[model samples]
Target: MKAMRVKNGLKISVIIMFIFMYGCKQSSYKEFVMADAVEVSESYEIVEEKEMTYKLNSNQTNVPLNLKIIKTASSRYKVKNIVTATRRIKIIAQKHGAYISDLRFQNDLYKKENRFTIKVPQKYFDTVMDSVNTVVDFVEYENITTKDVTEEYIDIETRLKTKLEVKARYETILRKNAKTVEDILLTEDKLRIIQEEIESAQGRLKYLTNKVAFSTIQIDLYEPVEYKAEPETYTKTFWDETKQGFANGWWYIKSFVVVLINLWPLLIIGLVTFFFVRKRLKK
Candidate 1:
């Protein structure tokens, strides 16, 4: 009985050991499978995110640009010299892929000025400005303005696309689904409005595009007034004194005439009184 009992205990121990080992293996396999599933899910998410990011990046059609306008004032010593500089400026502008949009000049005793408005291709804007700087003797003022229209441009582009899509939808409806005259007329009206909006947006886009592609520069050149004095010779001084005396004499004669006119009434009264007094004395 003692031996049987010992054998039974050994059998029980072996069975328990086998069951524990099998359970541990099963748990490890399940954990591995779960980990693998988690890894696959994470990888899929990463790929999906990458794809989304790429799509978003690809949607941008053009780079946003800032429109710039530059203004500068330069001076040359001589008024005539400014003309040469102006001609040279025009030549330089043309060589740098620029054009003179406006030119104005003023020639006067006080000041001489030459103003130019130039439009330069954006790619050559800096080159043109540098060339212009070389053409002047002195620089007075420089102003540069930049406008960020990226948001505005993008908004307009989006609106334009939406409008075009709406227009196409209307056209499709008009061609395929409009069964009655009323339907046709209504669709046509919608199409017209959409078309007008599209045109307006197009015009605005074109203006923005031009502003981005070209930069404006205003250049002002001037020569300040110079007063000259010449030394007077003795003969010239004598003539000047003579002319001054003649002017003073003329002024005195005019003063005498004015005084006589003012005293006429008093003189007339005095003369009458004298006549009356003489008559009384004679009587």
Candidate 2:
């Protein structure tokens, strides 16, 4: 009897372990499927029908990104053009937005800053972004993307039409007090899908419209200081100036001595030039 009891206990423990393992595995698979799936379906029959009609197709499509890469500022003229283009774009997209940059002071010295944005044709994202690097002062970063949403656009159109027709039918049934429980559930689901698709399409159309209408080019400009030579100016009475010069010369001599005392390196070079340069070069 003791042996039998022990055996039964072991069997129960095994069964419990198996159940826990299976539950964990099932949960993991569910998560994996959810993460990997597309939110919308591929069956775009209604969307296609609407496309033949007078409906917009943005809901089915998404942003196709064309990121720019800039290297050396090869042409100042191009930079100027880009600046002008950006200004025009800002004015046009004023209702949408004028994307402004944060004040990024590079260092203690105040530097000249330039910014620009360009909107290339969506189809030309790769080519335009690649060209950006050639005209920029420096390439800070780059991004590029291309997405085809023909299927999504089609799917949404089909769904929206079907839902609308179904909703109309449901209203008829509701007026007659004939909508069954299943009818209500079905109508609710269809309405939900229609609402979702409409929102999705509107968002996509807004994005595409923005892209087509405006192109932005972020630009920065740097100008190096160049040297110029000028004739000397001497404005002094000879005797007075000479005396003043002597004083200034004496002051400089003192300063130089202090500098030499601090910089052994300059002292060594000076001595070498003054003493050894002639002798060494003579050979």
Candidate 3:
């Protein structure tokens, strides 16, 4: 009987410990859920982007993109070198320059507090403010973006590169090669790629040469604002006023109709009851 009592006590102790442990685990889970719920507002601030495309040139346009940069005083540059070294590609970045912008690559992530510029042919407007993007490296992210601008960029560079290279080669062949048909034919195909390249390059060059040849990049490092509500839209448009008025009137009519339809049964029953009561009283 003593042995049995000891066994029962041991079992009771185990049950108590297990219940205590389970309660602790449940409390921990509730705390974790509360923490996650609190963090939701911060999660919404994650970086997001949209792609835009534009036909930036009517004339062959090429713009020379001058990139200026500022970086985290010392550490950022070293981090950028590490990123460039590891990837074997320098993701070219620029400054948001009325004065300056800062770009930092650290924690294996590219962080730009400055502006970025890419010399683009007017024909390749869709390509810029793109290409440099996050692959979601589980540890790092990359981003390159464009600034708000009243102007667009053009592509003239590719054409120039091709033309110059071709021009050099054509002169070389004309001066060096014997007049064999095969040699001439091969040279001609080369010339065709060169010609297309030249034409394309020229098209972009012309556009850049004419459009706003320079752009100012404004760097913003703060959280993006969906509304700038300080000294509001002082010159708010007539169209907006008209649209609001139209929406209010439309809503009022729809609401009135919905209430009428929903109350139809009540209205009909009341009408019947009133008529019956009136007829009986008169009789």
- Find the candidate with the highest TM-score and give its number: 1
Per-candidate TM-score against the hidden true structure = 0.54, 0.30, 0.22
Off by over 4 Å in 1: 1-80, 228-283
lDDT for each residue of candidate 2 in 198-283, tens digit (9 for 90 to 100): 67766765565565444444444433333445559856788998899999999999999898789998878888887787887887
lDDT of 2 at 57: 55
Q: Residue 92 of candidate 1: its Cα lDDT?
A: 88
Report, for every candidate in turn, its global Cα lDDT versus the true structure: 0.82, 0.55, 0.50
Task: Kindly report which residue stretches of model 3 are placed more than 4 angstroms away from their true locations once superposed.
Answer: 1-159, 214-283
- Model 1 lDDT tens row, 72-93: 3232323337778888988988
Candidate 3 lDDT over 5-38, as tens digits, reads 9999999999999999999999999999999987
CA lDDT, candidate 1, residue 135: 76
Clashing pairs in 1: none
- lDDT ranking of the models: 1, 2, 3
Relative to the true structure, candidate 3 reaches a TM of 0.22
What TM-score does model 2 achieve against the real structure?
0.30
Residue 97 deviation, candidate 3, in Å?
25
